[model samples]
Target: MKKKKAALLIALVMSTCTAIAQQKTPKAVMDQFMDKRFGMFIHFGPVTQRGTEIGWSRNDQVAQADYDSLYHEFNPRLFNADVWVKTAKDAGMKYLVITAKHHDGFCLWPTAYSDYNVANSPFKRDIVGELAEACKKQDVTFCIYFTVLDWHDPDYPIHNPHDTTQSKGLGGNMTAFKTRMKNELREVITKYKPFMLWFDGYWEKPWTTADGKEIYQFIKSVDANVIVNNRLGKVNDKLDGDAVGDFLTPEQTIGKLNMNEPWESCITICNQWAWKPNDPMKSLKQCLQTLVTSASGNGNLLFNVGPAMDGHIEGRQVKRLQEMGAWLKLYGESIYGTQGGPYVPNETYGATRKGNKVYLHIFQRKDGTLSIPALANVKITKAYFMNGGAVIIKTDKDNYKIELPATLPDENCSVIVLELNKDAVNIPVIPVKA
Candidate 1:
């Protein structure tokens, strides 16, 4: 009996030690990603100004051959890497992720893989190189976006043999394809080391099964600390791969991340990935709220902006992004270095908390006070405009109310801070799924 008792005590001690270690474990890398609430997603290549999608000139009513050949003719005389970096910084973006190579197989920098990059083009300068250097100089985290599937590579497999333009990662020699893909991947990793690697087009035909795993392992061998998205390839089960990169990145939309692990939502300012002469961009208010809403749900937003052919951002897009930066500058306390609330508000509002402070973001502000009826225990101490630094709050017994101000500091949304001594004790989050 004594021996058994000793064994039990030892087991308890080990368990306690393990629990303490787990709690004390520092999530540094993950924390850095979360702290940087905003980043710039660039989708610019030789195909811009041609008025066609960068990679899909073949069947998408775009000049496939001419679009592909634009790399040789590529020369952004007005291209200013510093200006781009400055714009992103001014817009509250802590990081910038650019497309080193899109699905069209046109390389932005000189690569030994093929003669289809900037080296062969009229633009003798290396755009990605300049951008990487600029980002480092400006204290911005740099990331690269590479298309796993290429449409223009001659060896690339295509179902329709007669259609030269439609061959987009359709049918290629698996062995040769893997080698060439790895070569480009190595070039990107070696030439310009990045904080994140956002991979796209893995869902195509041959990138699945063992081929996908092979590429995944190949990537890890080079940069194990690099973050990768779950969209590595298509699997029968969940979006699974060799787990080459860190983080799961979602494109186009935002909502409650249904994945078990960490995830992010990357959306665009306009409809197309490449900059169009006239494209409807998301409004200032929409961009601002979208960011906060995404953060509130424990996910990051990689906002995209496609630059014009002359290397200039659309004024409309720039204006809105700058506005977003100004708004973040004011209410950034609730965003940067913050974690997702255990209970998120539904339609009208959402919740994000850091340490002792819980930020009450009013997406849809009511007249006098926003009623947080569900938050029975939360005593409202102060409410203020995030952009202008003005306190606005009202309380009455157990029923605390939000006293709104007449003028809105931000044209978009309002950030309200609810000061409380303690957290909402055992509060049930009522997500309006309507």
Candidate 2:
């Protein structure tokens, strides 16, 4: 009788633990976001007309007066949200994020809170609303990129000596600026219902961590499911370990291998965020390599594209996107929804895993054979090229040697899928020499 009672107690505890483990927690929203490993970032505004980068150009390249007046002539007659969304869809991107408002203090959407919006510009069209509707129509998730540093808002408190006249007429109260920002965010959330809000320019004065937390909480109060980026109230743009934002936003650069928290690398397709006339763009190989590297690091990639002044995506950019889509079509299994490897990614290659399968991404196809050291504990039941065809893998003690065909499966990167005996993987983290 005593033995039977003990057995019953153990079963009850095991069942309870399993139920608790399966319960949805507060981190579910972030987990869902990490699952979407790739997204598109559209950077478009009046600044594209001058063929200069947005926001920063007001300080160096173009006079604030000319930069601000570009809106007067801003008319993107060729603006087509459907085509833009289609291009994103073709690129196998799960979401589309556009600059609803940039640092130049220009609002692409008609916001009742400010007159410095599309309502007063020559465009006179709701860019945000159109893109939101298009994303919904095409079944792509929609997000908004909003900047806290507004150069035109009356409530904004920041003042640069170079643009004293442009900064004039605005109330210089920090309290008023924060309130206006919150109110504008409320309007955006209620109107667009964005899946995420990618806030930028919070490193400026008057933007505090407390302020970032407040806005983040306010956003959750409006919609608990929405994700926020760490740029909100980032202290000097450094990563805040305890920030209220959902994920860390490392801009313009990728990081070393890290899966501690969900993070994203937001980089441009070309040199500039906004379209520059005849700008040298990244090659198809470079773009694919970026995606693989990001995935290997267990992070998402927000690839940026700057539309022309006429609001049309460049043919060259579109072609590269299409090519990337073709590559993803063949080997997306190794990317989307997969977690970073048990092994830390190195320069030559990286790894991703899903269930009992481990994918080795070979970036450098210099030799016809690839050798991965010190994976003795991992038992590979079968190995094959992700795209197609056979792969010969030999395991000797802790070493894994994969012999590849002379002709590579993909030109940019190749993926080798290995079926493991166990559902979970255990890889030793090799410290970087540098």
Best by lDDT: 2
TM-score, cand. 1 vs. native: 0.83
Q: Pairing residues by index, what is the TM-score of model 2?
A: 0.89
Residue 34's lDDT within candidate 1 is 65
Collision count for each candidate, in order? 7, 0
Which tens-of-lDDT digit does each residue in 1-434 have in candidate 2? Answer: 99999999999999986554323216877777888889999999999988998888886698878888988999999999999999999998989999998888889999888888898987899999999999999999999999877766656666442554644454577778778888889998999999999988876655677777777767777776788888876643334444657677788887557767788899999999999998999998889988888888889999999999999999999999999999899889888988886666766788888889888888777687777764545677888888587688876665677887877777788898888787744554445446
Task: Output the number of the TM-score-best candidate.
Answer: 2
Residue 178 in candidate 1 has what lDDT? 74
User: What is the C-alpha lDDT profile of model 1 across 367-420, one tens digit per residue?
Assistant: 756655435555445555554465654555544466666654444666666566
Query: Cα lDDT of model 2 overall?
Result: 0.82
Q: Which 10 consecutive residues of model 1 have the lowest summed lDDT? A: 18-27
Error of 1 at 248 (Å): 2.8
